[model samples]
Target: MSLHDTSSEGRLQGRPQTGSQPAIALIDGNNFYASCEAVMDPSLLGRPLVVLSNNDGCIVSRSAEARRLGIAMGTPYFQVQRQLERLGVEVRSSNYALYADMSQRLMATLERWVEELEVYSIDEAFGLLSRREGEDLSSWGRQVRRAVRRELGLPVAVGLASTKVLAKLANRLAKTQPAHGHVFDLEAQADPTPWLEQVAIEDVWGIGRRLARWCRLRGVADARALRDMPSGELRQKCGVVGLRLQQELRGHRCLPLTLVPPPKQETCVSRSFSQPVRTADALRQALATYTVRAAEKLRRQHQRAGALSVFVRSNPFNGTSFYSNSATVTLAVPSNDTAVLLAAALPLAETLFRPCHPLQKAGVLLLQLQGEEQLQHHLLQPLPPEQQQRRAALMAVLDRLNRRYGSGTVRWAACGLQPAWAMRRERLSRAATTRLEAIPRVLAR
Candidate 1:
């Protein structure tokens, strides 16, 4: 059935109209990075905009206007520089701080309506909604979208269905099909065959390029074909995972909403430097900075690492010479203290460093993480209770200061005063929500 044909007789198709069934909703922010930038500065609205990746290398995101202009995603910024300038397209470096702050606001707004929500990614969330008798999910979805726009000035598309996979498909249609009014509910349709046929197999959630190619070779071109494919053959070739996906498309819910996220197994902090560094001191500074970040993440999760790894690598693209090495050290006791992790990681950086090779990337990994409640005192190197208390108190003060005044307010001396190898974000926007100094000021005329 055409989405435009919404007559009761056509939509019902002998199936009873019911509203008591629960639904899964996939709410996705439209042009998330570009939307985030526009939220901060409304002047950029309706303009062709693109957000670049780390080091301002490639286009990671594009606004609707940019999409219409044929500016493909992942294109090298340098290659499109002249064209973008000629077309008067605006470009911004990836401002993660601003984007993260906007995402938090968006999620908080969604939590007000959803019974349970799973933050699937930085820009999308899966929500479980329990429908009341005679309730219209499409109406509820519109209200949610309105609230997000009013609160955060970010547009969203909502897709509702009995299962997650179908909800994902519905969400895609909600964005692409104007008749849905940015909200599509697959459960409301008596026969979803027409809609399922519209989705290509490759576009289905969890169906990667490899699986799509396999499906195509077997005459499965669209979502409906995959849904009705021979289960025995699918199971024989693609295993139980593929079967579960087919079941999901058939409106049998196999995936449940994750109300609570699992604890992180490890904390890693790694980055590519703006410029390559050849000195041992530069590598040490980079690793020390990464160690502090990893420890901060561990503390945030109320967890500590029992092992640490440090790695340094020269650019693989540099065909002249390439080098990569890593060193791991087992800690005496699980620790989230920056000083302790730094002490363990710095020496490894020194070991991995080669004087002649200009290393482009370095990182520190906090491994074998366990909750702070599971902390065990080492027999050989036991820390006194008072000393442990002091360390915890100091870290708390450091974190509090950083949160209030912005990051790097209090830092270890070893991280260096000014590192030339810092990330290149020349076009970065102000952290209006995060940093006090970056907040915009208005002047009355």
Candidate 2:
């Protein structure tokens, strides 16, 4: 059932092909990070490109040409440097700022075409497409792709089907096969199962290596096999998710096409080495740096922590001596103020520090977190009015400055020198908006 062999007997699927019924459209931008790079530099068009992780460490995404060289994701840049150079693969670091800004613009652009939109990933989104009088949904998909290209300068592939799962499968086919790369509509065929059967189980959504093995054990090897399995059995084995997948495969629309908001994180911090931090001071400095970050997150959330925990550990997996230590301290009063939180935790860090064990990682954690509330004013833990006022004023100014400029625009001296703890990302795209220099600018000819 290849795209090239469209025969007279194929016809279309028995499902209603009219526009009145609900149809799901899954949109995926091709080689998203590489596309991000290409959008910034038009010279990158049709060129081999690879994007690296933080600190220019390893490959994260590669263009089609680069992929043809057998380079893989997470392959250390140093390990494949010669091979990449020989293949002329352009490299860049993980420019999150650039990628994030582009993703936002893409979502905003899609908002114009459909009534409801669900952004699944930075490069993937789903929308409900309804037929207008005498209008073809396939043609509409081309228009959506054109809009993204014209407005955002990024190429996209679209898949249309009766269900979200089918739409996603169509999207995958649209990517692998250039003919379907532009548009894939399951309703246009009498039977899409033949095409669906070609997709491997592991490639399907929610079926990772472990699940794929489990599915293989049950003789379900492809999308069609899993689709045909009894829903009751799938529910019993894989729980609600497997049931949802079963329904989606059967085009029953069990899963809602919904946008996922960024999740609320439980903790936030930055950690680094001391002397290249082969010592306790380096570990302490790293912990202190993260303490500021944790406190800032707490205040930003309008919350406070009742306890602070500091941890220091050697690089265990690096074949070094295993040394790990951690200490937790209860605060007299829950507070988001940096001075109060750091004051409570710094002493604890000292207690947790090992004697010159070449500390590799250190971090701070805030526990028993709660939103700020009107205090009962405990007499035993009362702070002097002037001291409290000073603390509040100091933190306010620090937060303002950091927000206006950027993180680490100002830092407490105790946090120590920035370590090479950051993941290596050499071929990084420019930070399109964060720093003064990294902002994308229009150059007048």
Candidate 3:
């Protein structure tokens, strides 16, 4: 629990003393993935629906109706196959493009309302609220709720607080407690102890299982007890991080809203195939596609991977002949160039692939990532400047065309034409909301 930079923490005026206004709000999309599915196709409304993970293996997102019927999250689709059919449950494979577009729109709407925003995840964000004379913070939070609902057709819960930690706790309550308005204000609480006590020690945002165990060993059972413990004692045990969470529990600002996210240390693109692949060539096809995806992400982020790893595995469902292997290739020069990545990756995939066992999945991982500016040129093995520039320009053009038209509008032949190892999208929802050409048609009188 190392502390993040708190340079922009608290309110503009500073941490308010007694009876001050709320300064932080945690905005979270309700049932984000399921909601995304429902909003795009209103026909799913009030229906028992679950979005499956890659390979249609398991339920990753379930609508409220599906949950009510005891369809547990992460339950393998096979395990619940009979229940789903009997209950007339609808299924959709995850459409990340649609979800990502919706998330971008949601965050864009949020940015317009806040002074500063920290996007915590695809479905959660922390927004800073500036104290204003005659401005009701709670009302402002409510407006955010309304705006997202009306503009994006997305349901969100707002949790207003004096500190980010409390704001997170408030948001948790807003989600769990029916009595709390979709927007709950923790700053308004004269004493947060009672509410904090109700929250489990593990449920606090930063308190993971190890921390929870440590707290229990020290006789600090719940968040309230943790807050009541001397700040110095916890600091001694967990260093500055423990002290900060302790202070945050007592309604003090120790964590700041981050505007810029730290770059990913590694980029991985992988997925299970629709069916088992027994041939090395099929695995090569899968690896090439994943390499393209991973490299595309690396280039888009303005970073280059110094090492590439190729991994393949047999189906977990098959106990016999179960095999998985991975191999890593270190580059002489770091690059985001797709050609460079594929050249190294295909060879590794060939070595890692075992022809005897059928592969359920294959993947590519780009490691030792650094910004493009940090790349060091090899003294003797110099990449030709003219050729490099041409490839860069070509990649840029490819990305632009794909974005403007649709994904796979332009793809490398190495990825194979009609890859048989492609993941199943038999029950995939339409990307009407994301793709320019897929927008739904309307019938008029």
Which is the leading candidate under TM-score? 1
TM-scores, one per candidate: 0.94, 0.80, 0.90
Q: Per-residue lDDT for 180-238 in model 1, tens only?
A: 98999888887899999999998999999998999999999999999999999999988
| Steric clash pairs (candidate 3) | none
Please say which candidate is ahead in TM-score: 2 or 3.
3
- lDDT of predicted model 2: 0.76
lDDT of 1 at 57: 91
Error of 2 at 352 (Å): 3.5
Ranked by TM-score, the better of candidates 1 and 3 is 1
lDDT score, candidate 1: 0.88
Q: Which stretches of candidate 3 lie over 4 Å from their true place?
A: 1-22, 132-136, 214-219, 230-237
Please give the CA lDDT of all the candidate structures.
0.88, 0.76, 0.84
lDDT of 3 by residue, 1-445 (tens): 1022234442222222223344888999987888998898989898989999887888998887888898899999989888899999998988989999999999888876666779899999998755543343666677888889999889999888879898888898887887877778766666777888888898998898998999899898887898899878888888988888988988889898888888999999989889888887888888889999998899889999999988888887777767988999999999998889999999886688777788887889999999977768888789887988898898899989988888899998888898777877778888987686678888999
- lDDT (tens digit, per residue) of candidate 2 on 1-445: 2212224432222222335777888988888998899888888988899988755666888888788777888898889988888888888877776788789999877766665689898888888756544344777787888889998899899888878888989888888877765788776667889988989999888788998998899999999999998878788888999988888888898888755444334565644342235555555566777888898878777777877888777777667678887888888877789877878877776687667577666778888777666333457978777976687788889998987777778888876565445434445566655667666778998
Q: Which ten residues in a row have the lowest lDDT in candidate 1?
A: 9-18
